[model samples]
Structure formats: C-alpha cells, structure tokens
Target: MGEEENISVVVATPLVRSQVVTLALLFLAGIVNFLDRSALSIANGPIRQQLHLSATSMGALLSAFSLAYGFAQLPIGPLLDRAGAQRMLGAGLALWSTATALTGAVLGIRSFLALRVLLGLGEAPFFPASLRIVREEFVPQQRGRAIATINISTTLGQGIAPPLLTLLLLRAGWRAMFAMIGGVGLLLAAAWLLLLRRESSVRTPPAPLAETFAGWAALFRVPAIWGLMLGFGGVNYTSWFFIAWLPAYLQTSRGISIKTSGWLAALPFLAGSLGMLLSGVLADRRVRGGAVVARVHRSQVIVGMVLSALSTLLAIRAASLAVAMACICGALLFIHFAGTSAWGYVQAASPRALVATVGSIQNFGSFMIASAAPLLTGWILDRTHAFAGSFLLCAVVALCGAASYILLVKDSLPLSEA
Candidate 1:
C-alpha cells in the first residue's frame, strides 16, 4: 500500500502536458551528460599524443571521473532526499558545466584529473534525480517508457558525440570542443531551472532528520537492495567498457581512421537507443497485461545479459568491419534492454519516500565497478595490443551479471516492503 502511492498513478488529462515537458527536459539533460563524457573518449587519441601519456595514464583519467561520481552518491543521496531533486539537480548542472568549461584550461595531468573529478561530482546527481522525477510524475505503466526515453538520450548523445566531437576537435581542437560543450550545458542548466519550476508534480515531502536516517538504516536490512547493487555492478563493468573505450578500440585495433571510426562508433549506440525504447514499451505492456513485475523485469535482465554476452563473443570473430559493427550493435541493444528493465524495477520496488535514496545506491554500486572498466581495458589493450581480449572480458562480465541477478534477486518482489 505504501509502495502503491509511489508506483501507481491515474494519468489525468491535465497532467499530460506537464509530464511531456518534464520528460523532454530530462531527455535533454541526459544527452548533455553523456555528450560531455563521450567527448573525452572521442578526443582521446589526440589528448594522449599531446599529453605524452600512456594508455594506462589516460585510463586513469577516465577512471578518476567515475570514482568521484560513485563516491559522491553516498552523500548526494541523502542531500537529494532532503533538498528535493529540482534544486539539487540544478545546482549539479551548474557545477558540472563550470567544471566542463574549466577542463579546457587544464595545464597538466593533475589539473586534468582534478577537473574530471569535479565533472563527475557535478554529474553524479543527474540520473538519480531523473529517476525520482519520473517516479513522481508518471504512472507505473508509463514509468518504463519515461525511463527508456530519458535513457535513449544517453545513447543518442553517445551516437552523436563521436562524429560531432571529432568534427569539432578537427576544426577548433580539443580544448575548444570542451568549451563549446560547457556553454551548451550552461544553457541547458538554465532551462532546467526555469521550466521545472512551473510544473506541479507529486513529490515526497522531506521527513524529519531522525526519521529519514531511520529509513536509510532500514534500507540496509533489505537483501534485495544489496542484490540489485551487485547485479547492476556486474553489468556496469561491461557497459562502461563500451562507453569509455569503444571508439579507441575501433580506431586502434580495427585499423580504421579517426573520421571513419567516429561514424562507425555511432552504430552500436544508435542500436542501443532503439532497443531501450522498445524495452520500455514492452515492459509496460507486460505489466499492464498482468504479468508479475518481478518475473518480467528479472527475466528481461537475464535474457538480455545472455544475449549481450553471445553477441560480444561473436563480435571478436567477425570477418569484416561491417560485421563487427553489427555484432557490437546487437550486443548494445540487448544490454540496454536489460538496463532499462533494471531501472524500471527500481521505481517499482522502492517505497515512495526513499526512491532517490534507492536509486543513488544503485548508481553508486554500478559506478564503483564501472570506474575500473577503462583502466582494465587500457591495461589489457596495452598488453595484448588487440580488441579481442577486451571483448572477451566484457562477455565474461555480462555472464557474471546474469548469474548475480538470477541468484540474488527474487522474482516479482517489492523490496521496500521487506
């Protein structure tokens, strides 16, 4: 019953306009977030040469962002629960935008790492806050689609970033690219602050400090929360591999030029975006048709992870660049299908009072391991000098994620009520 207050919504006619606007804004924010991150990977080749850095050192820079993103979640979660998503996310947007702009001014490795950390900290609250907004604004049936729609922005941003950032890099250089993106972020941040203030959506009121802390304590007693964290962490290890290293892998291992790789790199992400959108529709339909929520969500994840693994393994054996790209696309499509289901479940399983807290934990867990993906991929690539080993490693990690979800997460259970 307590859970229903959060998960169930009667989509009134009057609410439609607000919901649409909210989703659109969130989608834009998602794009900006991913674009900022992906720009670094797209320009990594030039950055490495200019900085005279090894693959390992470049990997460290990438990991630094993720590490800060994950660590910030612990504190940010409580802050969001207290302060509200709109304000917190607005502040975060401004901070990260400044950090992104400042990236253009980095003088050395230390300054580079510091700014990346700041960027991570600023971006850390965006996803959890977005989930909270979706939970507050949409009915359960609509939530999956909303989550998927927003997540598609991630893929869209990734898909666009390679060619977009590469073109900018070629024209104005990497520093100018960062500055331009930062400017775009500032405009988006302003929009977020302005438009969101006008919408009247459902929100959980802040509880007393003691009561809120007590709720946080109770959350730790729920085994499913821990299980969710572990399962998602495994998935993140593989997903981050694509996010941080795919472009570089395409260029270095496949012998593609940077320009060609930029276009080719867009394929997998575009496929992933489409897959996420489909999963949203399917998951909502499944639930609306009276399928058990736990079974539907968990099964989606398990099946998706298995397919992702198989596709990735097949990618290494592909005979041509086109075939390899197709394989990677298939892999990402399945992975996003699984990822969307998992996020949908977060809303379905959480209590209304603690949705953001639960989501922050999920993000923290994923990024903790995800932070390692770049470093590990770089180390492996530096040693093996081929993409095959990295692809194989991703496949294995996806399998482990599947196993974790199957073993630890119970089918069709609302965890907050536990």
Candidate 2:
C-alpha cells in the first residue's frame, strides 16, 4: 500500500480505551509542566523584591530556564525516540519537580538561576515525548485533533496559573507556592510511572547509533525542516513573551494590582485554548473532506499568524484596559491557532520513525529564539519603561513566521525515508 493508504488503514481502526487513558494522562502531565514553568513569571515581582534583583537580572533568571530547555531538546529528542515517552516523561517530571521545589530555598540570583536551568532540563522532554505518543497512537488524519487535545494543557495551565499561583503567593507566599506545586508534580510523576508500566515495556528495540546519526543528518538536509525551525521560532517568540511577561506587564505598565492582573492575564490564555480547539477541528474536517493535509494545515498557520500580528499591534495601541484586554485576547486566540496548526504541520511533515526527533529539533530552534524574548523585554522595560517596543517586535516576528510557512513547508515529508 501507498503512504496515504497505510495511514487510512490505521485510521480505520476503532479508538481503544487505552488510548483514551493515555491521552488523559498526557493532558494532565502537560498542565503540571506549564504550571511549573509559569510559576516564576507569576511570582516575578515578589521574587525580584526578595532577591533584590533588577529587571535585567530577573530577565536573565527567566531566560536561564528556556536556554537550558532549548539546549536539552537536542539530546532529549533522540532519547525519546530510543527510550519511549512513558519512561522519559516520567523521569522528566520527577527531575523538574525537584528543581521547582528547590527554587524555594535559593538565597540569591546564582542559586535560583541554577535551579531554573535544572527545571528547564527536566521539562525539555515534554512536548517531544507527548508528540511522539500522539504519533504512535493516532494516524495522520487524526493526529491534528489529538495533538490539539494535548496542546490545550498549555493554555489551560497558563490560564489557571495566574489566579491559582496568585492566590498561593498571597496566602502562603512564593516559597510555599513553589514547594506545594512541586509536591503535586512529584505525586503525578509516581502516578504516571505506575499507570504506564505495561505500555513502557512494549517499545521498539533501540536503533543502531550510526544509523540514528545518519537519520539526523538526513533530516537536517530537508529544506522544510529549516522553515519549520524558523517558523516555530516566530510562534515561540510571541508565545513566550506573553508567558514570561504578561502578568508583570499588567501590573507595572497598566498600573493594575497583582490580584487584578492575575485575573486579567488569564483572559488571553483562555482565548488561546479556544483558538487551538478550533484550529484542530478545522484542520481535521478539511483533511477528512479530502483536502491536502499540508495545504490545509499550512493555510491555517499562515492565516492565524497574520491575524495574530495585526491583533498584537492593535493590542499595544489600545487606549483603555478593557480594549487592551480584548485586543490581547484576539492576539492570543490567533497566535495559538497558529501554534496548534504548527504542531499539526510537524506531524504531517515528519517521517514516522523520526517524529519526536523532528519535534525536538523544531522546539530547540524555537526556544533558542524565544529565550531572548524575556531578556529583551526586560531590558527594554528597564531602559524605556514601556512595552510598546517589545510588543511591536513580537508583531514583526509573527509576520515573518507567517511568511516562512507560506513560502516554504510545501508538502508532507517522504514516508519512505527515515
């Protein structure tokens, strides 16, 4: 059978109960993953005050996590392909949770920075592993919706973090907040390992090291991979900017209280969750109707990125808080629409055996670009005392990402090649 025919044959099988359970666990794990990442941002003000750090220092502290996370992706991708998601994800959850918990005890910038780096290392395997699971469990036509379902945890965690972490920061303080969140993650890790014990034992045998290296070299030669890398970088540049700075921006720039900022900051992420859901449904429907998978997903990504750029520019220009919030919501909605479609694009564009490797490489490039967002925004705020420049930069990057997808990433990758 041809590649498309093989995919159809896989899709024709009924969805099994184990797949549902696996997806549920993956979703839960994703929520905790983001919650840990966002904790520092939600408590940015308190941490800086307590540690006596400047905005630039705080920005460096934030960037430490992404820098480590991005670099770790290079190795973690190959590890996931060899070791399987069940083992890798469980181990990652445990390591990151320990790092998160240890942050509560740090005395200064250096120690906190170290813990953040560790946290990033621990979290690096998450998306690559999760995407691999989706690829293994679902066929091509169903992967978009499956991936979207997994991606929803990102926005949900972001949406919930502000209010939840704010309450924790207020009631128990930031240290206690980190400790508690880390404790919850540890529990989840144990649960994951136990639950997936059977599934973990059934992985494919490890590929020869030389053959694996050859596969990586071949993937690097594909032109579309470069487009994916740059395009994803644009998406992460905007997404991580909001993830790392939105709460603090509301308080400092808009003169809103932390409590109110916490609530307000959630609006955009909530909208983002909806956007991802919509994109998934739309992509699947079009593909099921005999639309070309790459064309459908790429068009969704391009349109979303363009709209996201426009909305971001408008958001920064809004005169009133309500107007700004509405515009920000619109921006996130479109940005996340692109984000989901981008992952779908990754799924459609990768060889089956190298799905996690491609995802990790894409994530590595994106985060390498994104790691700059927090630092740059912090530097701009310290110098100019405004977010206008930062927002404008994000809008420009989004447009560039749209152009990358439009001009490159033309079709599905060759299935015959690894």
Candidate 3:
C-alpha cells in the first residue's frame, strides 16, 4: 500500500482510531502490566520476613512466574494469531489482575508461588498481542516509533513502581498495595474490551492442524528466528536481573533503608525510559530516510548491548554510591535501547501473519533464559553475600547478545519459507 493509503486506512479504522485511543490504552495497559509484575519485587523484604524465606527460596518464587510466562508463549503465540490481540489481551488482563489481587491473600510460599504462576500465565500474551497490533496497524516506517512508545511503559512502570508501591506498602501495607493495583488493572481490562468491542478481530483463516504444525516447524528452521530468540534472551537476562532484584540489592548491599531504597531504585529505570524514546525516534527517522530496516535496527541493538555491558561491568566496580548509581543508570538506559530496537526489528522483519508467533518465540526464549537471573543471582548472593558476581554475569550476557545479533540475524524471515 502507498503511504497515503496507509495513512487514510489508519485514520478510518477502529484498530488504530487515528492512533489515539488505541495507543493510549495500550500505553496504560503496559504500565499496569509492569506495575503488577513489579509488586512482588517491591515488597520482597516484607514478604520474605513474614514468610521466613531465604534468598534461595525467594529466587525460586520469582522464577516460578518467569517459568510459567515463558512456557505459555509456546501456545499463546499461535492462539493470538488465530484468536486476535484484542480478545486475547483483554482476557489476559482480567486473569492476571485477579491473580495479582489474590496474591495479597496468600499466607505462605506455596500459595504465593501459585499466584505468581497464575500471574505469569495471564501476562504471557501482553507483548505478543501488543507487537502484533503494531505490525498490523502501523506502516513499516512508523513501527519503530510505535513500538518504542509502547515499550516506554515497561521502564516507566518500573521507575514509578518503587516509589508508588513503597508508599502504599508503608501506609496501607503490602496486601492493600497488591489489592489496589489489581483493582486498577481490572478497570483497565474493562476499558480495553469496551474500546475494541466494535472492531473486527484481526485473524488469519484457520489452517488445517497439519499445516499449522508444518508452519511452526518451518519457523523453527529459520536461522534469523533462532538468532532473534537467543539475542532477545540475552537482553531479557540483564533487564530481569535488575527488575527482579535491584531494590533488594540496594537495601541489603548498601545498608539503605527501605524508604530510601525505593527512590534509589527508580533512577535507573527512569534513564531506561528516556533511552527507549531516543532509540525509537532515531530508528524511525533513519528508516524514513531510506535506511534498510534490518540494518538500522540491528546496528542499534548491537551498539546498545555493547554499551550496556560495559556500563554494567563498570557499575559493579564503582567506588562510591553515586558512581554506582550513575553506572547502573547508564546500563539500564543502553539495555532499554537494545530492548526497544529488538522489538522494532521483530515487527519489521517478520511476515505479517507470523508477527505474534515470531515475537512470542523470541519472548519464550527470553523469559526462559531470564528466569535464570533471579535463581542464579540469589544463589550467588546466598553463598558470597555480594551482588558483584551477578552484575558480572549480566554484563557477559549482554555482550553475548550483541554477538548473536551480529553473527546470526541478517535478514527478514521469508514468507514463502515461513
């Protein structure tokens, strides 16, 4: 389609609604999604103390969510392609919100673990659905900015969660905090369903069962698919390491008070949010100026990963708290640049019919590798009583991700092959 026709279609369609209501709702949903995800980490100290859990146990608790979220992608991807983003995401929003609210009622590790798993399953559809919308609704050149706009919520939610949840934790207690966020999510879910209720579902015609399986097998054979999976996994490992453990790291390692740690933890994520915006603008501008889609996005991811790795490595060796915080902020900023670029690349590279499938496969690999972050970090902390080792591991993973994108991901997935 021509650019003018694409613009007119977007303006006329409810799928985008001139890119106003849809993007706004998606942004809000993204923020709520991260807030719900971050609640456990924000309240980690109180929950661990009340439940009498060790670092190792807490790590396992965190991994429970990642494990479920990761595996769910295997099925959720195809389901989204078949069912549609609006229906799938709306249902996921309600389910996860209910699970988040129910978490407050858990009395022990087992119960909490179960709720976390439920939360993961509910959340598994989020990015795949969101990215599929970007692929289908936005024109190719606009997708970088669109993807980045949605992604900013991830960091923004993380940035705000510490302070917001901390205040709720102090005033109403962690249980009340969870209940409140869950309520907000339930409201958002209703709004999402209402917003998209009149729109036709975006779906491909159902293929026969054998054809569906064959399509999946073909996707598995694509070299770029594997590259995207492993590269994104490296990105998530570093990001989740911080998201899952940064606040606790501040309080335990720096001897900072819980109240102080909340604000301190927000800084890096704020930087991350800024980095995503910058990367997105740069990506779209370059692509509009006739840059190759894969080359532009791939170079951004590679550069961001390398810088993030260096920054993380430096953070672990900083001599003062200020220096450490600066380095951490830099690390987050660059990693988010990589994260946003990776998503943009996925949208630009995948066949339209397989965007969600490709994205979900990448996500599956990401969370599966990322689940190791908390578990391994906690294990290291328990034995050595330091976070330096964990940070080093993240730095290494970032470098490896850069290498994977460089060596393996070269071109878009061919529709015929897929």
lDDT of 3 by residue, 157-262 (tens): 9999999999999999999999999999999999999887644444555333214777776777777778888899888998899999999988988888989999
Identify the runs in model 3 with alpha carbons over 4 angstroms from their true place: 1-18, 200-211
Per-model TM against the reference: 0.94, 0.94, 0.94
Which residue pairs does candidate 2 place in steric collision? none
What lDDT tens digits, residue by residue, belong to model 1 across residues 1-418? Answer: 1243222323423348888888888898888898898878998999999989889898999999999999898777777766678878888988898898888888889999999999999999998888888888877667778899988998899889888988998899999999999999999999889878643356577544215566666666767767777777766777788989988988887899988888889889999898899888887777766665546777888888899999999999999988998999999999988888888777776666566777788888888888988998889888988878888988988888888888877763354354
Ranking of predictions according to TM-score: 2, 3, 1
Our tally of clashes for model 3 stands at 0
Put the candidates in lDDT order, highest first: 3, 2, 1
**For model 2, how does the per-residue alpha-carbon lDDT over 1-418 read when each residue is reduced to its tens digit?**
0123222222334567888888888888888988999999999999989889889998998899999999998888788887768888999999999999988899998899899999999999999998878877776766777888888888999899999999999999999999999999999999999888765433544444314677666667766777888888888988899999999889988999999888899989999999999999888877767776666778898999999999999988899999999988989899999999888877666655566787898899889989999999999999999999999999999999888877767667552443
lDDT of each: 0.82, 0.85, 0.86
Q: Where does candidate 3 clash, by residue pair?
A: none
What's the number of clashes in each of the models?
A: 1, 0, 0
